[model samples]
Target chain A: MFDRETITNDRDPLRAQFQGMKGKLCASPELKAALITGTPLHTPAVGKRVHIRRFSKAIAVYAMCALLLLGTAIALPSLLKGMDPTSASSSTGDHDCIPPAVAMSSPSQLYERLLSEPNVVYREVGTIYFQDGSVKTSHVTEMTRRGDLFTTLNYGDGEPEHVRYYDVGGDKPCVYYNRNDLWFTSELRGDNATWAHWCKAYMAVNWLEDEHYEKTADGYKFTEEFIAEQIEEFKCEDAEGTLTFQDGVYTLRVVRHKEQFREEPCESVFEIQISFGNAPEIVLPEATICTHEYEVEVIPSDHPCRYGDETRYTCKICNDWYNEWSPTVPHNIVDGICTGCKLSEEEIGNLPDDDPDNEDHSDIIYGPYVEMSISRPSMQEFLEFYTVFQRKNTAPIVVTDLGDQKNSITQYHFYGGIINKNTFPDDYDYDYSSGEIRVPIQFWYSFYYNCDDAYFGTYDYGIVAENYTLDNDAVIDLDNIRLERVSTGMETFSAKHELSAKGKKEGEIRYYEIYSGENRLMKFAICAVASTEDSYYDSICQQVVDGLVKLG
Target chain B: MKDPQDDRAQIVENYADMVWRIALSRTRREEAAEEVVQEVFLSLFQKERTFNEEEHLKAWLIRTTLICCKHYLTASFRNATISLDEVGDLPAMSEGQSTVYEALLSLPAKYRIPLQLYYIEEMDSDACAKAMGLRPGTFRVRLNRGRNLLRELLKGEGIDV
Candidate 1:
């Protein structure tokens, strides 16, 4: 079983640590009083109370409602007349809201009545059945006033193929391209205008000439046919249409038996059903309007004309440019340089032979190479020496030496501070070649809770680098070094060792060494009393070593 | 007679630890956890609400702490960049305990909150589901997944738990 006990027990220590924090977290007395009283501690002049105080102004709303009710009753009939579905205009009271008892005599009268209704929506579904028995379905939705807000969703094989929204109320009508996710506006009024113009031009018909009218149980019906010459002009063998009106809606359908054009047998059908009602509210996205305005001017090329080059012209308005290529002589190269618009060598010699003594000699060298030796270490070598002392400390475990600010070495003094208040012997030397820095420090650890008798010792604490090349001269013993993987935003290994120095006892001095890479090694050593129990100093030393980061 | 201010204080005193732990587990930042704790308690102070039982109060605190932690993480003005050194000083824990805490902190938020509520708060799967506004089945699945991920992460760090 997975150990859930570990996670449950992990918070025990933290809970104990936070046990008494509630006393420190109590709200102030003033805050507690404000909370109990439900009053704002810092009240603003413009506040919620001010808004509540203004509700007394609502008494006039009832009087306004009574006036509106009286006005509505007086204008109710004209309002009903204006909203009548069958009439084109309120002034024309010829058509009733209900279908007339007398049948409409012609298809023209039906079409005129259907087109005249305001706020009407229609959906037309047409299926084209090919001679080969394949079928294709198409759908179109039309609305009069709010047609701009209508969306037509077309389905193919029981799945949505595309959606199109029309906005006709704007200055120009537009079709929203669902696939492109954009609206495309047209200069024409709308689809209805285009269809009306096409019908008038190609399929001109006189509904009265057909003289076919019937009154069905539902409503009236009318049928009309185009002339033979008009049918021929429309590329169809026959063209006919039917119109019906019932329940405040009109249905118009047209069928054209197309003559075989391009050796394909097909018939085209169009149907429109119109109903009058208030259009549904449609939310439209803010659309980007297309605008075009640019001032065009010819700008000549700023560069001088070269041989075999072309002249270029740019528009100052939009920086659009074009180049006109023309034939020209190529430039000649003399002494690995272009000689275009340059004087000959004889002309150059005639201009400059006046001052022989004043010639520039800065580029000429005066002496051969000389060698000198200085004992100061390079910046990289100096930082390596400095990092050894920094790695020995428990705090500021990570030190970044950015090197000298301005080509001079930055010297840092260690160990001779007021805290320690001790002077080192004159013979105490730092081994810079091996990257070693040794400082004498006192360290102590207690094992058995006897503060007075705790182990106190002094020893030389230092850091050393052991460079191991690929040739195995100085290999670390894997068995002897206790490795702990540490991450300082970069992975490295820390080696812990308990060893006896020249004067300290074995297992009394602790050493922590971090291996940066194959070449550089940083070590921290402290003298302490080591027992079988885990030493807190070891963890602290490990933390310091883990913080080591190379900033070179 | 007991006043509402005393009731609010009693609630804060009782549930502050659980709320702080949940916030710390979710945010993985001590300062952010402290801020979430303050926000949760301040909301409880401002709103006059009644709970059916002590369990309901605990659930409300956990839920509010999770929300506050999420808000702190996603607030536009919150600093997005925090260095590893800034997160170095965790509340003192044993080395092994620190390893477990790191493994828990490394988990994704969805799994971390449910795991902390279930294991640390000793809330059952149903209670945890109610606190997180999740179905019992979904909470169980997340708990199991979170446990497995934590086990793998601890194993990678050479910790058995």
Candidate 2:
């Protein structure tokens, strides 16, 4: 009935073009040579999304053997007293490669970075997933981003919601939004209303819990409690969220909160797609009730022991008012016992112990430890020293900051005073013997994604995987590491090692030689931005800790 | 004495064009297509895969090309490159009459990919669907839509389809 040659007849419009394209394009010389040589013609590119070549049987064997060998060397438990950030001594790690300006970031850092983008869009798709594997997608909240300057259209749902934008025309950083004429503006220009509002709207997850410093081989995976009260419609309770970070960024986050006290269980789920598409402009409607005059009702703050005096001002009419997280009230210490919460001085001393894995604090601030302000780099400086850029305060993986530096090779910074099972020994039901890492194996899995996200947030370039990795002795002398730039560069990270991990992380493949007496294990991570496969000069990635790790 | 035949080199030579064309259809830029081809073959050479059948190898190449295309065209990649540099924009190209190539290029990406694989590579609907990660029924629907769209595009240009 049909033949190949006859089917490619002139009757088909594509016949001529296909043949033309075929003639013009051919295999390049490098490709042919690489095929013959069995070497890669081009190094694989990194950033956004990456596909892992499934390890073969032989390679898997070799990898297992290597992990076994590595296990012996890295297993020696190391200890470091963590800096409480408010009071107590600075427990800055003895990291030698600490950048001058940037601090290492936490998983929360990704949200901060995404929210900071001017031209970004996030579609918070809420789906109610049941234990039976059925799902009911209820609502979608689409937030439009335009960096600090881009105009945003809040709708890809056919119906455009009221657009929000920043206006330099009026005054300070002001966000104007109107939903069907009920217009309002944020006090972000004068106060911290903008940041506080962003905190409430998105990125409400507090990563300062006990989950930090833990390790996930492929990506960073962490779990935290999901407040059931946040969702009124779903009526969910005892919610817990498991977030999976494939590379350095979280690709999937599944939050499971059950409907209140039901024998048959269900969970609430939401997937946020960080859209890079340009925001279409919409004319703002005439403002009717833009400003809200709240009847000032002062809710007495909670004790410094819990929630630090929860004081909030909500407008009498609408949900509009100034919100702030005031510092913890001074503890009334009389004869070594806190009069307010009855916590003893000796008990507080025992809080900061030898365990180097987690910070025992949750939502509680101890003493007068204020969030110290650090200087961030200028925009021009940030762009200049991006990927593969030179760093100023480079150091050997040696004991430079040996003076009282906490050698706790950890991935998390635990804030003190949180009344958790570990923080308060009052919970007899708590198991102290479970999941304690006294000798934490320190490694740096900083994602120096100075490179662009797949135009937006949908793609996962596997480069984010093994690309930015550091496998070394857990402790680094961090006191000398200064903060110079806050941008995500591979260098310039300071104690601000913990803007919640270090200064702007970059992608230069920096090596830290680890010494175990006779044997030397070199741990170095290459930035996906700096060491893109296109930048073929970064042959050191071949010595990736996850892949073909070169050992001597 | 002749050296052992390099299977990798022979394989690359065989499929580089198909992979590049499929990538070109998706990405539209020569550079992006070339880069995608490189990644596909490099992935092939690096993996310790044993392809028993010729169709299986072809399927792998097609699948890989599709994946690379999905990852290749991000905002970061666009910003990283100087320009898209489409084939039509080259100085030597003729102008005036809209060629079948231009008409085909004008279609949406979803249709263009299936059209190229089904018509250009002469792949059946089932094989094309499998490669594109689509159901056989869905693939048939897309193929019809593509044909209709192409026919309309050509008819508008005063060409018989």
Candidate 3:
């Protein structure tokens, strides 16, 4: 048999080969950047723009010769005409004096038309979310292009806020970030110059009418959703734009989402603001994500029976808000029926509670220590529960010596009298008045009838353990919490109990502990379910122990 | 709330490679493996949940990686073409190691996974079985059978384990 040492020894091939797996598979920083920032990495070389030819080569070649003959005749006349009045002929750079009002894609003949366009500044106001639609480490990116100089400031939380300079013109924009590594260049290449995403977005959008519209008194209002497929300069799996014309003004909003690691589209979209050329000396904002200094209000559900509360968190700064669903309030149970939910614990266990008189009494069957039942519980006598549980109950009634696991030829009753090491006498003649029960902290109870299956069934319980008087119904911490109904909400306290009690035993042992701040006593009424076949009895015993009101 | 970047770094450090390996094994494509790892981590970081044990976290990554692998294979929009070179990582040739590695890859995953997990990953047989969704005894039998086949394959290659 091959062992760990045999397989993993330094001399071995398996271990040696795998030792370099990390090196070969070492994750790229771009991958980490993509994962962290949610950027797409699929930068296919901006594919050549396909042009559909209108005419075939044969016809075009024949027509070209005729046009050239006519053009040469006109040129001779024009040259002669110009020579007679020749002073000096000159031309200027083809750049237009004005920059485009909208920026996404610039004209392809940039060399001809770019020089005249004035320096442009792009500032993204408000919040900038990452690919995961999270504002964590959010920063603003400001780009300004003047002549051949394009400066970008990407400053904020997740990464070090730094100002980078790029010499832009012609090719890709290359940036050198760190002072130490002077030669290292950034992916901030000429292909992905600061304005490229905007340019790509502008060029790629094929605006389609949105199916959804808001009905208005005049007629209807609709927005156009622009869709962009794979474009090389952009890394996103897709980019979408919403263009809406309202009144006399037009607005465009673009959103991009992708994880470079997967090179796939994701649901988390980042909404960025793009405005062209109004070069204001750009400055950073006070908050990358909203400060959310505004107060939040949580309104409880009107249907408390089923739905929990709906809460709204609003930001005073941005008026940006989100909502959340809180869990339903604990079911309101009265006499085994909830006034709030109108369902009893038995009904929740699944059946309607038609019998008004048949109120559940878990304390009766599972001993007085347990205050309530979470799952439906049925128990009659201790011996009956012990038999099926495979545990011999070593209650004081059975074992003379305390803390003993197996009590021979004997049986036990469930008795929890913590604070006193000694167990109550076999015939203590106890009533359901004053009982003190705290588990495993000071006392241990091992009651067994038989074996294996029983040990597996014990589940731990935690509680506040404050002095609380038990009533016919359950409530806790007594006078501190004056609610009439049982509360399942447990506070964190380092107390736990797993009743590793075993087998079929059904018997009543009652003494309801009373501590209403000052040790007062009250007896709880008993409710017993009938026991039948051994399996039937064991199943009920399991529920009794199982139900022990799962505290947390 | 916890700092998101710190949380991301911690989760990536803890499970990135484990996820990468599982994804690589299931998808059998380098590109698909990277995609699966990214998707799994994205889903993990996006959702809000807590695990009491690192074991539970690992189990979740395994399950999620398998699901991601399935999605990658079955996605209607996927256009990626498979390349033989991208299928798996190659080990350095030393002694009969490369031969052994090739044989291991040739075996069916059901048998291969048990051996790899137990021997290569140093996971116990019980954990290997649980991960493979098989009973402990079944996993042990497969391991033994897989070992025997590997030896036979190696012998045929003029080498002995």
Give the range where candidate 3 chain A is weakest over 10 consecutive residues by summed lDDT: A46-55
Query: lDDT per residue, candidate 1, A48-92, as tens digits?
Result: 112111111111111111112222223222221222233222222
What is candidate 1's lDDT per residue for B1-161, written digit by digit as tens? Answer: 87876776666557766776787777666566666666666666654555556776777777767756654654411143322233446666666666666666667676778777776676677888877766566688778777876777678888655
- Which structure among the candidates has the greatest lDDT? 1
Best by TM-score: 2
TM-score of 2: 0.32
Q: What lDDT score goes with residue A374 in model 3?
A: 14
Clashing pairs in 1: A148-A166, A148-A167, A148-A168
- Which runs of model 2 end up more than 4 angstroms from their true locations? A1-24, A38-44, A47-552, B1-5, B75-85, B88-98
- The DockQ of predicted model 2 stands at 0.10
lDDT of 3 by residue, A190-260 (tens): 22222322222222111111222223574333322111111111322334455435452224344444322
Q: Sort by DockQ, best first: what order?
A: 2, 3, 1
lDDT of 2 by residue, A1-552 (tens): 777435545466555545544544455677667656756556545421221111111111222222122222232211101111222113232222112122212112212323344344434322222122332222233333343432333332234444544442332334344434323332222221222122112222212122222234643233321111112212223433333333344322234344321234443344321111223254443222111111112112221111111122222211111111110111222222222112211223322333456563433322221111111121111100111211111211111110111111111111111112233212111222433211111121111111111011110001111111122111222222221112111111122121012222334433333322323222223222222232242242232322212221
Of 1 and 3, the candidate ranking higher by DockQ = 3
Quote the positional error of residue A476 for candidate 2 in Å: 62
- Please give each candidate's TM-score: 0.26, 0.32, 0.28
> Is 1 or 2 the stronger prediction by DockQ?
2
